[model samples]
Target: MADERLIAALDVSTRAEAEKLVTQLGERVGYYKVGMELFYALGGDIVTWLKGERKKVFLDLKLHDIPNTVGNGICSLLRLRPDILNVHTAGGLRMMKAAAEALHSAAAEADIPCPKLIGVTVLTSMDAEDWAGLGHTEPVADSVLRRAKLAQEAGLDGVVASPAETAEIRRACGEDFLIVTPGIRPAGVSHDDQRRVMTPAGAIRSGASQIVVGRAIYAAEDPRAAAEAVLKEMEAV
Candidate 1:
C-alpha cells in the first residue's frame, strides 16, 4: 500500500542536513514537513528544492498574526506551493478564514492546486496545565475540540493535533476533515518535550489522516531503517 500519509518532520537547520536526511530516507517517506527552524535557515528555496526532487512539502510555519498580515503571509507562501500549510487557531476565525481565502485566490491566480490549510489547535508539548497557565479554564482536550470546531467553520481543511485528541477532532469535524498528528512516540520511546503522544499504529487507528515523526526517526542510528520501521508499523494497521 502507498503510505502517503506518513510525513517526515525535517527539523534540521541546514540545507545539507535536510538533503542528507531526504537522501537517506529515499522513497520510504513521501511527505516532508519544513518547520520554522529549517525554513528560517534555508528560506523558501528549500521548498522549491524539495519539490524539484518530487517530494511533497508541508510548510508548518504555524503563521499567526493580524488578519491582513497572515493573509499576505499565506499568499506569499503559496508561491512555493506546499502540499500542506498551517496557521495558529488561536488567531481566531477571522485569521483562519483569511488564510484559507488567501490560499484560494493565490492558487487560482497561479493556476496551481491550493495547499491544504490546517489549523494548529494545541501544541502537543503543552498539556492541560499548560493551557490553564495561559488562562484557559478548560482542559487541553476541551480547548482542542473547541478550536477544531472553529477551524472547520473557518473553512480550514483540518487541524494539527495530538493523537490523543484525534478521535474527538474527527467526531467534531467529521470524516473528511484532515487530522495531522504530531508528538508520536513509537511505544516505549521517550516523549521528550511532547506531553501528549501515541504509537504510530495507535494514531492511525484513532483516525489520524497523517502523523509527523521527528526525533524518533532523525535521532535514530539509521534514519533509513527507522523510516522503514515506521512505515512497516503503519502497514500493519
Candidate 2:
C-alpha cells in the first residue's frame, strides 16, 4: 500500500525556480519541503504561494537557537500555516518543547490547524566520524535514538532521521510517531553530499512515515517525469 508521504525538496535558490518545479511536478507530489536556500531567498512568500496552489508545505528550517528565540521563530512560521515544521534536536529538550508549545498557542489563537512539529535528530550528511568530532563517544545510531527519545518526551510529533535509523526510532517511539527520512537517492542516482542514503522503497519499508527526495528528482532532465517515477517506486513497496 502506498501513502502520500513523498516530500519534494524545493532546493532551488530562487522563488521562480522553485515555483517552476512545483508547476512542473504539479500534483504528482502532495508535499513540498521549503528548505533554507529557497526560504532565505523568498521568505514566507514562497510558503504562501505553495499553499495558494493547494500544496502541503514542510518548512524545513531546522531551527536551532535558545528556547525563547526558537519559540518566537515558531510563532512567525505558524502564521504561514505550513503543514509541517521542524527544529534541530541538538537544540535540546527545552528548545523542542518551547517550539511545540508555541505551535499550540499560536494555532489556538489563530484558529488554524497546528503544523506537525518534528525534531531533526542528525543530518544524514554525517556519520560516526562526525559524531566523534562532536565529542560524543557513542555511534551515530545511538545518538540519533537518544535525541529521538528526548524529542518525543519534549512533545514533538516525531523526528527527521536517516533511513538507517527509522526502524530504531519507530521501535523506540512506536508506530504513531512520524519518521521523515531525507538523504533518499533512487536507484542509479548520485548520492551527492549525502553520506547515508536509501532508495525510496527501502526507506518507506524501513518504517519511515515520509521520505524527502531533492536532487534525485529536481535535478533530472524532466523533473515531473522523475517525480512520477519516484512516486511509482514508492507505490511498488
Candidate 3:
C-alpha cells in the first residue's frame, strides 16, 4: 500500500488462498502479515514468494520459549529476513533479551536489516471476563502496560497491542516504540471475535504505528475495494 501504516493480514489457511489475496490486493497493499494460519501450513514458501513480489512481511509467529530455545529459533529465522517479527512478552525478560540479542547479532553478521522486534502483549480476543477466567485478578490494561514496559526494557522495538491501549502504550513507551494494533473494526463493521475493537481512524488517532485488518478486507466480496476503503479511512486521519 502507498501508506506504510496499514498492514493487510494474509490470514488464510493455504498457499493458494494466501496468494489469491496477495494477487487480488496487488500494489494497493505493500505490507502483509503472515500469521500462524498460512505460515505453519506453507512455512517459508509464502515468505519467499512475498519477497519475490517485493512486499514487506510481518512474521507473526509470536515466539515464546526458554531463553536459549527462543534465541535459537530467532537465529533460524534470519534467512527469511521478515520486515518485522513478533515475540511473546509472556516469555519473561531473559527470554525476550536473548531473542533480541540473537536477532541483532545475527542480522549484523548477515549484513541485513535486523527485523523490527515487537512484543505480543495480550491477545485482542481476551476481555475482562475472559481474563478473569485465566485466574488472574489484575486488569487487562495494567497487565498490558506492564508487559509493554518489560518489552521496552528488554530492548524490543515495540508491541502488538490493542487500539484501546495504543495511546497509553505510546505515553509509556514513548513515540518511537512501534505500536501495531489489531482488532480493528471500522464503524458499521462486525467486530467478529475481537473483544477490544477500534476503527482504523480511531486506531491511527490513538497513535498506532500500524494497524492490522483481516476479516474486514479478506472476508469481503471485493478485497481490493475493501482495502481501498480502509486506506481512505486511514488517510482521512
Candidate 4:
C-alpha cells in the first residue's frame, strides 16, 4: 500500500545518502522526489540510479523560465526518464504548453515513456501573507484553482499544489488530472517550514492523487516505521 501513492522526498545532498535512505525504506517507498538540493549535486545520476533500482522518481526542478528555455530543459530531463516532472505555472500558459509539447515530442522520438508534466500552482511554504506580498490581491485558494485551470488548458497532466487546495483542483480539473501534494506532516508532527499542510489521511480524503512527505519520515529515528505509519494513515482514508 505504501508503494501506491506515497512519495518519500530524498532530500539528502549526496547520491550515497539518497541511496542509503532508499535501501532503508526498501519496498515501503517506491516513489522518491529528487528536488533542487540533491539534483543540483548529482544531476541525472540520482535519477538513473533510482531507475536502476526500479524505483519511480519525481523530478521536482520546478522549471520556470522563458518558453523556449523551459521547453528545452524539459527535453533534456526526459532523458533521465523520471516518472513525473513539474514546472511553475506562473511561467504562464505558453511556458507550460511548451514543456508539455517538448516532453511528448522528445519521448516519442526516443521511444521512451514521457514523464507526466505537472504545473506548480502554489508553494506550500507560502501562506496568505507571503502571497499578498507577491501582489496577489485575490484569495490564495482562488489563485490556486485559477492556476490549476490554466495548467489544464496548457495541456499539463496536473499540478503540484497544497493539500488544502487539492479538493478544489480535483473538482475543477476532474478526477483524471494528477494532483501531487507535498505539505504532508503526519499527525502530532511539527509542520516544519511548510505552512499549508494536512495529515496523511486528510490529504487522501481531500482527493490528492499522491502525497510527498519529507522530514516527518526521514527525520524520524526509524524511517521505515515512520513510512509504515504514514502508509497506514493513508489507508485509513
Reference-based lDDT, each prediction = 0.93, 0.92, 0.94, 0.93
Per-structure clash totals for the candidates: 0, 0, 2, 0
lDDT per residue (tens digit) for residues 59-161 in model 1: 9999999999999999999889799999999999999999899889999999999899999999999987887999998889989999999999999999999
Using all chains and alpha carbons, the TM-scores for the candidates as numbered come to 0.98, 0.97, 0.98, 0.98
- Lowest lDDT 10-residue stretch of candidate 4: 1-10
Weakest 10 consecutive residues of candidate 2 by summed lDDT: 1-10
Question: Clashes in model 2: which pairs?
Answer: none
| lDDT, model 2, position 123 | 96
lDDT of 2 by residue, 12-79 (tens): 99877987898898767779999999999988999999889888899999999999999999999898
> Which segments of model 2 are wrong by more than 4 Å?
1-3
RMSD (CA, Å), each prediction: 0.9, 1.4, 0.8, 0.9
For model 1, the superposed segments whose C-alpha errors exceed 4 Å read none
How far is 133's C-alpha from truth in model 2 (Å)?
Answer: 1.6
Inter-residue clash pairs, candidate 4: none
For model 4, residues 33-149, the per-residue Cα lDDT tens digits are 999999999889999999999999999999999999999999988889899999999999999999999889999999998889999989999999999999999989999999999
Q: Model 2 misses residue 146 by how many Å?
A: 0.5
Worst 10 residues of 1 by lDDT: 1-10
**Candidate 3 Cα errors over 4 Å, as ranges:** none
